[model samples]
Target: MSFALYLAIMMTGDQIELVQESFAHVLPAAAGAAHTFYDRLFTLAPETRALFRGDIDDQGRKLFLTLAAVVDALDQLEKVVPVARALAIRHVGYGVEERHYSIVGVALIETLRGALGVRFNPETEAAWTSAYAILSGVMMSAANETASVKHVVAA
Candidate 1:
C-alpha cells in the first residue's frame, strides 16, 4: 500500500509525530534502554531467552538500530514493512515466535519510559503501541507465510 493509504488504515500523523519525538529523546540513551528492554523481555518470558545465542550487547545494538529504522520510516511505512517482514522471517530461524512480539513491545515501551523518564507520556506510549502493533503484525504475517511455504516445500 501507499504511504498515505497505509497511514490512514492504521497509525495517524499525530501518533507518528509522538513516536518520533519520544524516541528522539531516548535515542541518545539507546544502549542502556536496549539492555533494559532485553532484561525486561527475558524476565517477562524466560523461555524466549534461549533465542539469544549471541552476545547480548551486540544483539542490543542491532535491536536499537532496527528500531531507529522503523521509527524513521513511520511516515513512509511502505519503506519499513519490507524490512520488518524480512526481519520477522529471519527471527523464525532464531526461534522467535509471534507471541514474543508482544513481550518485546511491552519491554520496548517500558525501556523508553525508563530511559526517557518524564518525556514518556501517555500519548507517546499510545503511539509506540500502535507503531509496534503495525510493525509486528507485518512481521508475524510474513513469518507465518514463510512457515507455510517451508511446510509445503518439505511435504
Candidate 2:
C-alpha cells in the first residue's frame, strides 16, 4: 500500500485522546521508557544497532524528547510534519531503510505496553497503532521523495 493511503487513515479523536493521555503517564518515567524502547528495538532489529554511534543513553533521551514533542503536537500535526520530514531525510542519510519504521513501531507498542502495564488495553494499543501508522507514513513518504530527488540528480 502507498504511504498516501496510510496517511489517509488518520486516528479518531478518541484515539488521539487515548494516545495523549497514556503518553502523559509515560512522561514521568520517560528515561526508563526510552531505555526500554531502545532495548526492544535493538532486540527486534539487531541490525539497527549499527546506526547509532553515540551513547545509548543520550540517544534514548533524544528519542524520548522527540516522542514527547510529537505527542504534544498530535492535534496539530501540520506543526510536526516539517520536522518529521527533515528528520526522515536525515535518517535516510544515516542508512535507515523503509522496513525499519515497522520495526520501530513494534518496539514502540511493546515499550508502551511494558510501561503502561494494565493501562495498555486493546483500545489504547489500537490508538497507538493508528498514530504510528500516520506518523510513519508521513516520514516514509518524505524519505522516498528525498531518495527520488537524489536518484534524479545522480542520473
Candidate 3:
C-alpha cells in the first residue's frame, strides 16, 4: 500500500538472487504468519471460520507452506503471469476479498519483523512492501479474472 516502499524495490537492481535470498530469510516466519493471520481473521469475522473444514490445524501448516513455496516459485517462475492467472481462478471459490489481503500483508510483515529482529531495517521494510504489492496485484488480477470466468478455487 506504500507507494514509496514499492518504488524502492522496483528500482533495486538485484534480480533472482536477491528474491531467493529474501524468500530464504522468510521461511522461519511463514508459519507464525499463518497463525497470526487466522487469529486476526477469526477475531474480526468469526463467521468466516465456518468456511473451513473441521481439520484446521493442518490447514494452518498448509497455508504457510504453500505461501513460502509459491513465493519461492514466483522468483523462478518462467511464466508468472499464467501461474497468477491460474491461482486467481482457484481463489474464486473462497470468496476472497481485496481487503483480506491487507490483513495477510500486515501479519506477514509483522512475522518477518519478529523473525528478522534487528535486521529489519527501513530497506528491508521497503523490500517487503514492494514484494507484497506485486504479490497482491497478482491476487487482485486473479480475482477479477475469476469473476469474469465464473471459476473458483477452494481456499
Instruction: Choose the strongest candidate by TM-score.
Output: 1
Off by over 4 Å in 2: 1-9
Across 3-107, the per-residue lDDT of candidate 3 in tens digits comes to 334433452545434445665776666666567767766776676687676467677787666666655654444344456556656666766666767766776
Q: What is the C-alpha lDDT of each candidate?
A: 0.87, 0.89, 0.63
Best candidate, lDDT: 2
Residue range 76-131, candidate 2, lDDT tens digits: 77777788998999999999999999999999999999999999999999999988
How far residue 115's Cα lies from its native spot in candidate 2, in Å, is: 0.3
Q: How far off is residue 62 in model 2, in Å?
A: 1.0
lDDT of 1 by residue, 1-155 (tens): 66436644788899999998888888888888888998999999999889999999999999989989989989887788789889999999998888898898888888888887887888888888999888888898899999999999999
Indicate the worst ten consecutive residues by lDDT in candidate 3. Answer: 2-11
lDDT of candidate model 1 versus the reference: 0.87
Q: What's the lDDT for candidate 3?
A: 0.63
TM-score of each: 0.93, 0.93, 0.69
Q: List candidate 3 segments past 4 Å from native.
A: 1-19, 26-30, 41-48, 74-78, 151-155
